[model samples]
Target: MRNFYSALILLLCFVACKETTSGKKEAEQHVMPSAQAVDTLLKEEKKPAPKTFRTFENLADTTFVRLADFSDGFAYDLRYATKNNFLKEKVYDCAECYTRVKTAKALLKANEEFKKSGVRIKFFDCYRPNSVQYKMWKIVPNPQYVANPKKGSIHNKGGAVDITLETLEGEELDMGTDFDFFGKRAYHDNFDLPEKVLANRKLLKETMEKHGFWSIRTEWWHYNLKAGSNDKVANFKWNCNQ
Candidate 1:
């Protein structure tokens, strides 16, 4: 009778140990991932990289380039392409800002600085063709207002731009007068204006000057790239429909 009880106890102990081992095996199987799953976790999903833009390294300094093609950080309200300008007529077939590669480089750098101050460059005019200058002269023959197409202005050389500063929200800051306002109010030295207007002009002038551009006395918005003064006047026109 004693031997029979001892054998039964031993058999019960063996079954309990076996059940514990089986439970432990299932717990480990639930926690551990399969080899394929481990591979998937270690490998990253493939995705296309963003496109890189070309730099001016290979381009000539005089080569004309569309500003938007290099950087979209600028705002455009090309006045000559629309009748909103002083000419009261649309002289340009399209609204595109093209400048010499050297000029574009300086502009891009200047814009980068402006962005840090929560403002950006808004172009009123850029790279006016020699032919367009003649049309402007026909409407406003005054040398104070329009450059003679015969001699050609810095704008015809793809080196000059008329610009204003605006908040990132597109609200143009008060520069004392509207673009192409042919009067004393637009003069950079005319500090007789309000304090706010002078401040705005100062900001535009200082920031632009730091980027290798010089401002004319009469137009607060006009800036000429120092290097662009010598480039030949061009009649390069952009396609309107494209």
Candidate 2:
């Protein structure tokens, strides 16, 4: 009878041990999923939110707007913002592209057309403040290059842009001279250039004209919006901290 009791107790102990081991494994399985779920949630939270662009739906045409805030399609060099420009001095506090709402609209349309030709506009300068115009004039007091600050060029009116063509992949097209090149080589009428360069310039000029922009005779890169010419010359500066 004692041996039989002993055997019964052994059987009970084995069953209890098995239940404990199984429960432990089940608990571990539950705990592992909870840990993995927490990890996934953290990763999702750390991910950056997608960028959003502003629309010109109700904005006034004369209102100034940053081009990058509207679209990410175009490129910029913004030479005056750096010392690489003809002035050899950094004129702008920061590099930012801003234009009148009407000018921006025309540019967006022009960029779309340029994209069709596997190229896009790359700006060297745009929408210069009247104050910056004075800085440029002080550096080069030539009417042929820098416009008079008192008179205020189309740029100060937010109507002009110095731009060039580049491939969608960001390769600049050869147009015989770089931006701010003051010579006959950069002149629109001076056609003594390689066929490739002339073709590139022609593409830019024709496309810009189609999109309500007119080029200057002296500078192939400079273009003025036909409708934005009458806008007031602005000294409004962009906030660089943003």
RMSD of each: 6.2, 3.4
Q: Give the per-residue lDDT digits (tens) of candidate 1, residues 1-242.
A: 99999999999999999999999999899999999988886664554555566678789999998888887689999998899988889999889999999999999999999999999999999999999899989988988788889999999999999999999999999888999898988888788999999988998999999999999999999999999998898998887676
Clashing pairs in 1: none
Candidate 2: lDDT of 119?
A: 95
Question: Any idea what lDDT model 1 has?
Answer: 0.91
Instruction: Indicate the worst ten consecutive residues by lDDT in candidate 1.
Output: 44-53
Candidate 2 lDDT, 1-242, residue by residue in tens: 99999999999999999999999999998777676798999999999998799999989999999999988899999999999988899999999999999999999999999999999999999999999999989999998778899999999999999999999999999999989998999999998899999999999999999999999999999999999988889999999999
Assess the local accuracy of residue 21 in candidate 2 as a C-alpha lDDT between 0 and 100.
Answer: 99
Which runs in model 1 stand beyond 4 Å of their true positions?
1-52
Model 2: residues with Cα > 4 Å off, grouped in runs: 1-47
Best-fitting candidate, scored by TM-score: 2
